[model samples]
Target chain A: MRHSSGFRAFRAIGLLVFAAYFFIPLLAMFDFSTQVRGSAEGRTWDNWAFMVTDEDLRSSIVASLLLAVFTVVLMVVLLVPTMVWVRLRVPRARALIEFLCLLPLTIPALVIVVGITNVYSWVTYLLGDSALVLTFAYVVLVLPYSYRAIDASLSGIDAATLSEAARSLGAGWFTVIVRIIMPNITGGILGAAFIAVALVLGEYVFASLLHFDTLPVAMAALYKSNGPAAMAAALASMILVAVLLVGLTFLSRDRHKQGASS
Target chain B: MVGAFQDENGALTLGNLDALTSEAALTALKGSLILSASTAIIGALLGALLAYLIVSMPPQSLMRRSTLAVSGVLAQFGGVVLAFAWIATIGPVGVLTKAMDDLVGANIYGSGWLFGLPGLVVVYCYFQIPLMVIVFAPAFEGLRPQWREAAVNLGASTWDYWRHVALPLLLPAFLGALLLLFANAFAAYATAAVLVSQGQPIVPLMIRQAITSEVLLGQANVGFALALEMIVVVTLVMVAYNVLLRRTARWMR
Candidate 1:
């Protein structure tokens, strides 16, 4: 493949400019967050250090971290089994399930929040207004992404044969889903979970509008008095999300390897 | 949403929709349309260009994989954090604004346009471009070299090959990605909520106001109708996306 010099130059310049455009603001955030607020002084660790010591910010991060864990668990548990069941037993329902899952994409979070705010008056009365209650909605929020990722994995693997193999060996439905099918599709499940976690971390609408005071909300609140510290938290959250995204790419890629065998 | 259509007596009525056609509601809707459409056009084109640039790189290159992975995260990047970054860049006392002031002796934020639609387009583009890349990058990779090679062997020039073959094949996917991008910007709430504080010039902000801000007796229902209006718009976009996706899948898959 002989590449022309002009074409190569164009790609290099194009990518460089786009990368700069995308990465510069992120870099600017890093730069601004490090510098002392209100004074033109050299960079300091005051804000980044505040991430650990600031009680409210720390609590918010911890709360969001817990929510992310719960959201991922609920998404996998609820979706993977239902998806496996649909694939193995009632394949015709796949389209309906898919449409239902992807419906959240078209329906904005604000609309869902409007319905939930109206509906969850009862839910709050019953369960109390705990941030953990936000997890239930978070699962629905992540469904479109999770379902697509999991479905791609299901498609890549011969899920039916794997399930049949377990069943013929006298495995029950639970064993089939938990032991046989899940292992084969662990890559996809992990990928979906990673993305779910990232989405939950940076989520603001449902949390802020619903008044859940998640990490993003906490950061926004902090922005009024502490600009640098808020950016620090934002930087930290973005890094965590970036790592998860990288992990997801690797996990999905790993699926291709196992996909050949199954 | 039923609450939005309810009357003063809590009786259901279409009067809340009358509010939907109000000057304020219409302004917010117009603001949303302007922001989302412009972001979609600029973001989709920028992303397509970047996707092409990445695809031009060697597949196994570390740069290619890392860029793709980072794009995935950055595409999902929005909300309060994104607003923070933009403020740091262009807001009063912002780094770039200060630097430009020092060098060019011009105050960029002096006009205070950063709080309105112009600043929003710039801020929104940050996520929009990356999102477009995440959506459209795969489409770029799906282009087979053989198509170009075969076209060339058939005596077609590069322009003819791209215009006749590549453009037709890629158009649906491009449109699909663009629509998703539109729906994304249209439905977005947090960034605008944080940045545009003068007034809620967007529907998402309007919904928030209806729900949270100065609670009038009937504004809640009006808010609900506004939410419905947003959903109706996004549904049309999604339906269009589905059609385009089906068309894309036929050729791309």
Candidate 2:
């Protein structure tokens, strides 16, 4: 297709408009965080210092890390076996299983919190309000992304052939799955885990509803009370997420290369 | 009912599981569906338009690459920050609202749709467009150059080419993207809660209310039921999209 100058000019204008729209808010956030306390004085590092020094903020960061790790672990434990089983034993139902796994993606976080709270209120009530319930909801929240990554990896492997080979070698179903299939799809599992960690870390609605103080919720609370400190937290979060996104992109690139080589 | 399991000391009991389907639970379920479906439809339409504009542009352009990158970032940057931005832009004391009120005698700030369904839709669109672009870009790339040339060579007008050749090829991808947009919009909570009026209860807001209420005071079971209902509806929509994808897989080629 040939490009025209008119189209080129239009593209430039569109790009500029969209770029400004996207960056202005981010700039505003930066400005809010850096401006001197209470006055329009020039930028300072006070907000960052405050965000780091606050015990509650520090605790929320630790809590977020814990929650994310738990969510990632739970997701892998729940999704990998179910996905492998569906792929190997119930191939025809792969579509159905995939649908069920991704079902959480359709639910709003608040709604899931609502459902889980209702279904597990007795559990929460009994446990005296532990973070366990929030962890379960986070598991559901990351299910779709984890399932997609795992399912895609499963599709790349010849599950039937691998299972057959393992069985002929006198391996039990559990052993074949544990020693053979899992080691093969480690990349996908890792990729999914990374993505799951990011999602769980960023999740706010579920944690807030469940009364757990995850990072995002904590940041939001701080933003309401003290805007500058919240901006520092937000910047920290953005940096963390950017690193994870880069890692995922690299994993995806490696996967592509592996696919091509095979 | 689930609360029934909580003893004086807040311990769990098997008996509390039965509270998952109470009257309050049913109401929350209904509210989630209505809110999710409404937001999904609105978001899907706006997202489709944004995706179309992005994809329809010429290749190798800076605009295309930047749009792609920015959309990727914005799509992920939702929640409280997004809510704050929207308020900054159009809330009662917001720049846009104040300007409009001063210039046109229109009080669009706190009095009108800006704080209600309209505001929700606007916030939903902010996230939805980028998502749609992500999903639709590849679908658009799948369009064969020869098809467009063939349409032109056959004396078809631009409109005819788009209607007859492009739309058919893009329908499956569009539907898939729409399903995703629906899911994202339906599940969204914080943006709406922050931007919209508290009096107008969306399912998420309602759930939050129930959860935050005094122990043994609010209808938490109903909130759970509402969440369940949302899950079911989103599941059904996804299944339907998958079926459509399978059926149209050949056609998309």
Candidate 3:
């Protein structure tokens, strides 16, 4: 397509506007995290120090990490085989399965928290309340993203050919999936795992509603108590997300390279 | 767990679940539906406009790269930070609020639509626009130049071309984006909780209150009931969206 100077100028303006919109808030958060007192003063590390020193803060961070790990494991176990089966055996129902996987996207986390709390309250009355209910909710919450990554990966392979090849080698259905498909889609699994972790780490509504002490909940509690320290926690959370996003981007780039080379 | 359901209160039965439905709860449900639907419509329109404008511009590699980066950031920025930024800009003590109050002797802070429903719709629009762009931009890119030229050659008017050809192709993407926008808006709590007043509570806020009060006061059964209600509603929405996505994608096969 041909271009004019007017078009170029308009493009530049649009880019700048969106860029500012995106970056300004993040920069403000970072500024708030470092700033001493209520206002944005000269740079200081006191907020960071406070965030690190607080015991509940540390525990919340650890709990968030555990939740993320649990979510990733659960998502992989459920989604990997489902994606493989849909692609290889149930192609007709692939769309149906995909829709089922993405259903969580439509349901708000807050609503899910509410619903599960009700069901679990009955269970808690019987089983006694545990963090297990919260973990189950996290699995449902991360389902949409996890399914997407795994589905995309499964679609990338020749499912029929691979299954046929494994069958000819006298491998059992389970063994073929475990030994062949699993190794082939490691990239997708990793990407999906990271995405799940990111969602779990940042989740606030579910954790808060369930009365579990995740990092975001802990931060919200602290925000009510100490503004600066909470800001520091928020900044740390953003940084954690940024790092995960960067890693995912790199993995995506590598996948693209492999795709192109092959 | 099964036995817990057997426990009963005097003169209160499972058949009386209807009694729990009150005017206040009904009002909140109605408000949530209205707010979510309106925001999704307005957001999708504004987003499509923005997407169209951006894609129509002559493609520069750097421009495309930067746009993706920016969109990624904006799409992911949710929760407290989103609420805080908007509040800082336009809340009661916000820069514009204080300025308007001082300059015009009219208190704009917490006094008008900007702080309540109107303000929420605007912020929701902000969140929705970028997401719409992210989802719809790829659809726009997938439109081959040959298709548009083909439409022009057929003597189809510009509006007719868009209405017939471009729209049919774009329908799946547009619906998918709209569904996503609706879900995000519907599910949203942190933004609304911080931005809106307690007198006008959303479903999530009500749930939060129920949980906290029940836990603190040891009213577990009531909280359980409320949570069950929320789960049922959310599950229905999820199922509806799933059906929509399947129906839309059926044509692609």
Candidate 4:
């Protein structure tokens, strides 16, 4: 159980090297975003201020966030029940759902964007270019991740027994999924939601190619006018995801600890 | 694409596959392969090292838990946001470049190579390394401490233990993560699109160009062909990954 001093030192150095590699760029971004350009006046909130003042950027941030909210809701609703149902009721179809969920991983984003461009014409014609319609594709993009996380959580629970237990108590099918299975997989669902938020926030190609004014697309567009400000927006977005990621870690960590103990 | 396989006279032929064989296509393929290969190799090595570190850590420790938590998100961190993160550090007007200019009278972002392969690799590795951890760590957890105790009981030193037991166990997992990373980097679109926008440095960008600016009318289908090629690469990589995963599962058992 004792780690040798040399081994400990090696571990420390390796972690340190990677931590620096990981953190420095983000730290630099924070510094760059705050610094006043062409002024002797040191750091300022100018870029952050610009994010508030720039109407388009402001709107894009809001729009993207709203889209994230919708996307996460969509993902949970669409995936959670289907995955749970397949496990409990139609275990034979489990493979089908798994393949469908993981289909996006094999198909490149470019191809998806290309193939879906045809469909989006109909989507936009029906829904208009409000950028919210991008949520459908975002759900597909998040499917593999969300499915994996939720499935892992589901695996930890005896789904059939739990469903049977709930059903024997006169719980309806919907109630079994919503009340029982949902509470059980909260950790996994949150983990999946965190990933969805990160993916939707930084999502670029689908948003840009589809002509949606999401935050990343806006950041790229804003880069031409104010590089530092765009970088600032990026830093803020990273910070948001980092916070979400931290939250996710805590959620899953609690579940992991519970899992190990139980 | 029908156009890609068509003859010069517009009759369907094997000639369009030549579009992929041209110097530009070859260069982009080479660029994609080199970048993806390096990303996979480097990501697998560093990520496996990190994974090993986590597996060694006290399971209840914050370090291991935090690493898993952070690695989950960081692995997925790529595309436009990633490009800007690097630019903020090392872009032409980036903080580091400016600092170096002030400190040593040299500009790091000079010559503009960051807009090319080297920069792409650095940015790509940001996500690739952590992804390797996410993909590889679970397999590492399969190493039973009882095996180590049993190995030691059998008079095996640590080096001998790894040589005979650990390395063989981890090799399939390491290679599996490597292939996944390869496909991950290869199919990536936004990072390169945002970083190196002008030229066709990789397949994804080439496809984007073909669709957006097909010089000839039928050349549009060429873009679809390129996308198909990317999907083929991804399919092969996933197949290899599934095979490795089965191999890993057996050893774990």
Candidate 5:
């Protein structure tokens, strides 16, 4: 095949434009965050420091991190057993299970918040007024992404065969699931956890509208009082999420390599 | 959704459905439709082009892998951080706005349009384009090189190969991805809610207003109606998307 200079130039120019479109806003976030308040020149680290020093911001960050942890825990505990049970016993329900898992993707979170007032009232009554109750909604929010990730890895390994082998050896159901199949799908579990954390951390709609002061909601509030500090927090969280998601690709790629080699 | 049909006393009624046809609700729906459609269209075209350009690189190259990884991150990027990022770029106190004023004496930040519908489109594209790339890139990769080689060997030029072979093959996947982007933008709330603080220019923002401040005690049902409307629109788009995906899958294998 012969390469044409014109085609190569087009590719280069196209890539450059895409790069600029993506990177400029991110760069501007950093630039805007460091700009000194009420000054035409120079920079200050005060805004960056506010991420930790501000009381409301600090508590919100903690709340969000805890929410991410709880969501991951709940998603794994709730989904893994049901999914494995379906594969082992009731294969007839696979379509229904798949549909239900993917249903949240179609029913936007905004809709859930709007329609969930009655359910949340019961939840708040039982769980008190803590923001951590958002873990339930976050689990539902991350369902489609986590389900796809976990399902892919589950399919990669022969779950039924592994469970059957363990069963024949006189192992109990708990051990078969927790000790055998669970270890085999560690990569998928981790991928799911990473994605859940990323989504939970960045989530704003449910938390904001529901009157919870999570990290993103706090950032919005902070944006009004202090613009530079809000930009600083926004840039910081964006960097963290980018790192986790980019790391996710490398993690999955390494798993693929390990699978091939073994 | 059942709540949308119920009145304040918890009795079922059709009054809330009537709220959807009100002047305010109609305008908000129109704004949402315009925003989602424009962003989806522009995002699809640009994202498909960018995906093709990236796919032209060596499959395992570091640049290619990083670009794909970055695209994955950006496609999922939304919410307050994204809104703030745009503000930092072209908002009133944005860095570029100041830089442009200093260098060329041109004020790009005219009357704070970054907080309006046009601003929403540009900001929405920040995530929409990357989403299009993530969903559409695999289709481009699935284009077996042998097909292209076969086309070229059969007395076909590059233009002929793309027009006759690639374009038709990619049409279903492209349309599916476009619908996915539309549903994505339509259901989005965080960015719009954060950007447009005053007016309820879109359905999601209107829902927020309806929930927060009620003219009557049970006026919040209007928010229910609006949310139901969003779900209906998004569900339709996603169903069409799934049908296109199934068609694309038949040949992709």
Candidate 6:
């Protein structure tokens, strides 16, 4: 554990280099967002205010937030029970389930947007023209990440034994999943939900290509006429996502420490 | 979607592949490959170094934990937000550019190449490096200090210990992380889409063009074909990554 001065210096310099690379642009975003337009040396809040004041941008922001909520709800509803049941009853299909969940990682979202045109035509025809239909695709997008999070927590508990005991005591499948297994994986569920929210907020390809106005698509559109406003929006969302992810990291880390102590 | 790859008679054919051979398509493909490969190499090297530094710190240290938390955030930080981040830093009227002009009397912002391939590489590396750190750090953790101590006690100098004992063990994991970064950069669409608006400097932009501005009626089919092409390339890279991961897991476990 003894370190030479040279190695210590190397490590210090390396950290400083990375710190600069990462932090400078963020600081620049803050500076850029507040710069007074058509003025030489003053700051203004108009760009930041435009986020709420502009009708198009404000609606897109609302749409994106709703998409995040629906995506989280859909992801949890669809994935949690399937993952838990597979781990319990159909252990034989665990590999297949995992592979399916992780398939989106290999298939880019662009490919999905390209191929889903046919499917979305039916979906749009049936559901009417609304952006919320994107909830289905967003669920698919977050599957691999949320699956890993939920699966880790699922594996950490004795799901089979707990469910068996519940079954023996006359608790139905719904009760077992909702009351028992869900409580145990709340940390993972929260982690997955935070990630999903962050991702859905920043998603652009699907919204832009599909002609649905979302936060990022709106930011891109705003960037054309109002660069400062778009930069402000981008910085704001980036900070929001950073807060969510950093919080998730702390949550998972605390859970790990608790698990280790126990 | 698969129908895009078929001929008029509904038979699967290489007719769509003809679209890829066009001058613009080839340029975009070349640009994509070059961008992905360069970013992978740079990200792998720098991110490995950063990971090594963080791993050497005490596990409970705030610096180590925060670096990891920040890396997790940054790794997922891509798309239009990322493009705006860089522009805010170095765009024509950006903060740093303005500050430098005022204070240092030096205009570092040239003819705005940040809207092109060089800029794309810089922006992509911002995310790619953090992703590399996230994926490669576990490999660094897998290297038990006792192994290094054992090598040292057995007459290995610092360089000798790293060269002979560490490098060989880390190579497979390093390559695996490199491939993962490569695929990450390759599949990235949003940043390029936002940053480079005028021309199709990359395949993702080309795909965007095919989708949005269908000069011809069936041009969207070319986008489908290109998506298929992206799927094949990413699938192959991931398969190789999985193989390397299995190798890493053997000794790592």
lDDT, candidate 5, B1-253, per-residue tens: 3343243325215468888899999999999999999999999999998899888888878888888899999988999999999998998878789899999989999998889999999999999998988889999999999998999899999899999999999999999999988999998999999999888889999989888784657767777778778877987898798899899998789
Q: Is candidate 4 or candidate 6 better by DockQ?
A: 6
C-alpha lDDT of residue B175 in model 5: 93
Instruction: Give stretches of model 2 more than 4 Å off.
Output: A90-96, A122-133, A163-179, B1-70, B85-116, B171-176, B214-218, B221-247
Query: Candidate 3's C-alpha lDDT?
Result: 0.70
Q: lDDT by residue for model 3 over A5-63, one digit each (tens)?
A: 88677767765675565555555556556667655548788889987688999988888
Given candidate 3, what's the lDDT at residue B180? 71
Worst 10 residues of 5 chain A by lDDT: A112-121
Each prediction's TM-score against the native?
Answer: 0.93, 0.80, 0.79, 0.90, 0.96, 0.96
First chain of model 5: TM-score?
A: 0.96
lDDT of 4: 0.84
Off by over 4 Å in 6: B1-14, B103-105
Chain B TM-score for each model? 0.93, 0.80, 0.81, 0.89, 0.94, 0.93
TM-score of chain A of each: 0.94, 0.90, 0.87, 0.91, 0.96, 0.97
- How do all the candidates rank in terms of DockQ, highest first? 5, 6, 1, 4, 2, 3
- After superposing candidate 4, which stretches have Cα over 4 Å from the reference? A38-41, A155-184, A260-262, B1-18, B102-107, B149-155, B214-218
**Model 5's CAPRI class?**
medium
lDDT of 6 by residue, A1-262 (tens): 6778998899999899999999899998888788877645889999999999999999988899999999999999999999988888899999999988888887778877887776677888999877889998899899999999999998899999999999999999999999999999999999999999999999998888988889999999988888888889999999899999999998998999989999
Docking class of 1: medium
Against the hidden true structure, what lDDT does model 6 obtain? 0.89
After superposing candidate 3, which stretches have Cα over 4 Å from the reference? A38-41, A81-100, A118-133, A159-178, A253-257, B1-21, B57-60, B84-115, B151-176, B194-197, B215-253
Per-residue alpha-carbon lDDT of candidate 2 for residues A78-157, written as tens digits (9 for 90 to 100): 88878888777888998887777765665456654554554566667776665655677778778888888887887888
DockQ of candidate 3 is: 0.25
TM-score of chain A of 4: 0.91
Fraction of native contacts, model 2: 0.28
Q: Candidate 2 residues B55-129, lDDT tens each?
A: 767666666655676566567767766766656556555546656888997876656566666567666777776
Q: Tens-digit lDDT track for model 1 on B121-217? A: 9888888988888888888889899888999999999899989999888899999999999999998888988888778788898888888876475
Q: How displaced is residue A136 in candidate 3, in Å? A: 2.6
List candidate 5 stretches off by more than 4 Å: B1-14, B214-216
lDDT of 3 by residue, B67-116 (tens): 55456546666676566555544555454565677899767655656656
